[model samples]
Target: MSTTTLLRSRPSRPLKGGGVSRTSPLKPRRSRLLTGMMLLYLVYTLVPLLWLLLSATKTQDDLLSSPGLWFGKTFALFSNIQDTLTYDDGIFLRWLGNTLLYVVVGAGGATLLATAAGYGLAKYKFAGRRAVFAVLLGAVAVPGTALAVPTFLMFSNLGLTNTVWAIIIPSLVSPFGLYLMWVYASDAIPHDLLEAARIDGAGEIRIFFTVALRLLVPGVVTVLLFAVVATWNNYFLPLIMLSKPNLYPLTVGLTQWSNQATGVGARPIYNLVITGSLLTIVPLVIAFLFLQRFWQSGLSAGSVKQ
Candidate 1:
């Protein structure tokens, strides 16, 4: 075979109406309007955070005197932190401990329950499964606030009001977490894999632990983060349930500090309040940073079919 004959016999590429090559790749056009809007949004989001960071470093007078985006003359950040920790007999530390306790027990329990329930719902076939799903959807739609009054009344009847159980108990029920895990598990864990484990004399529980659990890591982490954030940021439920100042979480405790600025004989602790608010969000930021990879994977899992 000659080179000329080989070249002449090769297939020709198709063209569009005006003879433009169909196989040619076109670069995506960038929209300046969208880029400018995004820049504006970035400024809007960062400005508040910058203001908070700068404000937390100032004394009460300096906070009021200094421009929001700029630092004050005397940097009192360390002193402000000391004051926040030591003020009112170190109640901030107590609130911190309480918040940790709630997050660990409530959020942790919620995740465990959600994982198990979601996995079971995804894999198992039993009576009333559709009903269970319907109930879950209904529960998810009903905001927590709507259930608060009834929950309070029930807790009051049981003499459980103002106790840690009041907060921890309610935090364990995460309908959204369950729903998310169910959806993730249905696709992520193959039915054939589970059946193979069973054929090899592995019990259902053993199979789930050794086989399905590994595939469910991203989904589990995603549910856990959601539960953690929800339980950590819970405000109204704890506010209405617990009247004891010592039992308060950081959310309610910080609000109390913020309110000290108003009314007669008010002691304005703006410096501590600002500093405390900064402290409050640090753990959440850390959580997102650490678990972000798993979170992103979980979100994108079912997007493309294998």
Candidate 2:
């Protein structure tokens, strides 16, 4: 064919909406708006934390004189920590230990019980399952504070008041955790997988341990972290249960120290309070950072089939 004929025979490309073929640059207004919203939220969440961090590094005088979100004239973070640890015959260290103990036992046990119960409720079909779930859902709606007075009275009658058990025992029943695990397990652990494991001669317990447990890691971590935080920050329960300062967790202990500021003998250690608050949150931040990858993996596990 001739070159002119061949050129004429080629079809012309259609224009989008029969308009100009010129490409428009991608509009970034939505992206910018989303970024702005994220930044606003970050600032809202971080401002208080920043204030705490900065205040921890200042002496009482400096804290009063200095700007709220900037460094003070003198950096006294190490000294503040030392003073916090050494204050009142080193009671802060004891409080720290007690807090750790409560978190380990209470949160760990809560996680285990929640995981088992949730998995059972999701996978098993037994008598009173719906009733149990209904009661659990109702329990979840009940604020813990509402139960504190009754719990105190009951524990007092049982001669368990002013003991570690008062704190640990109550924390072990996490209705929210149970509910979370139930929802997560229902989606994460496929029915077919469970059937396959059973076909291969696996017992229910063994299948749960080896198969469901692996898949439920993210939800488990979430519940465990929440339980840990709740137990760590628990004040009312420990305060109402235990009369002794020796048994106080960090939350109660810190508050006690803060109250000394206005007590008749008024020994204001605001620096230590601020410093201790900063230190208290550090472990939680570390836990999140460490478990973040696993948590992310667990959340996304069943999104795509293998």
Candidate 3:
């Protein structure tokens, strides 16, 4: 009879106020507003990329006259790509190669050095650690553009200006990346494991490489993405540091060709520029999609024994 009665009774009343909180009244409105804003933001962000994609499909004349949001011709994409490739003795390919090299050399080094330094700052205790961190924080505040002149002069003194090292070396030190690592290491890496590793006779470098680094991968990936993007898009530094046309990265190369497109009666190479720009983004997009796997945090779940 008790079992029958329990089966027949309504489920015990959910604890009154179990779900909604005091702030519940405002939630629907806030959610609606946030949804509206996000929709607007999506349109704003995607609109330009859409424009670029559509524009890349048009000829130079069609691009200027056509409504950018819609397609005028569906099949010009292949022809545009062909022209972009063959344009001006294949300088486009050279520029693409240069950009890739710069990104890999500069951003790659920065990611590694930042990871090591960040891990050390986050996990280790030594004299002047706080002071060193404070200095790094200050370095972040100093704009990269602001230091370009000083950097150029220093590089000039060393005969590094106008060379790949001029850009690559500067990119090796990212204060922002260091700070990110420090923050991530503080919150993400568990200290109990560090003690355990010490108990097992793991040397500092071994523990960091074999344990801490694998755990802090998301933070490392985040910094690497930023560094790669920064190095790829960098224009001002390369402008000041490198003058040789052969040494120009894509940003400078594109700007040079783009400017020449405006030469009197040359008929603007807008189509080529637009098309090339789209192609330039392909490697980065592909890289993000591929390297994202490496960025997963908590991947080292079993590295430190329970």
Candidate 4:
């Protein structure tokens, strides 16, 4: 046989130990372990939510009488929702509206500021950049709750207490969100793109709004969601800052309702509290679900290089 024919007849073999094998014995084990861990996490996360779901369907007596995780004899979800909305002259609805307002202004502002600041920090060679980052890192390490008292005092001195500004101002500054945007912008946005935009006679502001902002959408949405959740769930700051029930966010307002279940002249409206809590989470859940696609797309896009 010719040498060429002989070589051709020989089966092609992969280079020794160089390429990844299609089937590895360890892979199945790793996959199973990962799947098990994920399932465990899902169960852990869902259990409380499940309990909340079931508990919301029950009346106060049924909630006390029934098994904690199971449904009651009668489902009163709609009735409970009605009571929750109408209670105290629809103050719960007002709290919900106030929470939305805070989220819109505070979280929206935070996202805008964080995105601009992060993009600038990533793209620009500014003076005091290192010091700014150093302060930001330090601030990130500090617990927000620890600063609540001091912030309340400062706001009080400024005569901003009992006003929406007290909550909105504090919520606007998100060190972590800024850091996230910085990292995402550094990776997601190409410097060449910015230069190209400039070459086209675009101003810095124009480049940001037109070019960089489009790429930063995913990160911006992520930061916005975080800010929304933070502002929406903010309890301590509002508790300290606002003296009037009219100014309370849902978190504080709901807690006030829950507290009514205890002490003298207690309302015993535990059902309403549970239902309100359930209602309070719906908008956040919807926001997450709606924005999930953008978040995932942004993350995936950021992971790839130009």
Write model 4 residue lDDT over 1-306, tens digit each, in one string.
344333333324213354545465422225687898999999999999999999999999899899999999899999999999999999999999999999999999999999999999999998999999999888888988899999888889999999999989988998889989999999988889999999999999999999999889989998998899899989889999998999999999988888988899987789998999999999899999888766665656565553
Tell me each candidate's RMSD, in Å, in order: 8.8, 10.5, 8.6, 8.8
**Deviation of model 1 at 155, angstroms:** 0.7
| Residue pair clashes in candidate 1 | none
Q: Model 2, residue 289: displacement in angstroms?
A: 1.9
| Residue-level lDDT tens digits of model 3 in 228-265 | 98999889988999988878888888788788766576
lDDT of 3: 0.80
Instruction: Name the candidate, 1 or 2, with the larger lDDT value.
Output: 1
Candidate 1 wrongly placed segments (more than 4 Å): 1-33, 304-306
Each candidate: how many clashes? 0, 0, 0, 0
Model 4 misses residue 103 by how many Å?
0.6
What is candidate 2's TM-score against the reference?
Answer: 0.86
Give each model a TM-score: 0.88, 0.86, 0.81, 0.87
Runs of candidate 3 exceeding 4 Å displacement: 1-37, 263-267, 289-306
Residue 149, model 3: Cα distance from true site in angstroms: 1.1
TM-score of predicted structure 4:
0.87
Candidate 2: residue 55 Cα off by (Å): 1.2
Give the Å error, residue 18, model 3: 10
Better of 3 and 4 by lDDT: 4
Q: With candidate 2 superimposed using the best TM-score fit, by how many Å does residue 275's alpha carbon deviate from the native?
A: 0.6
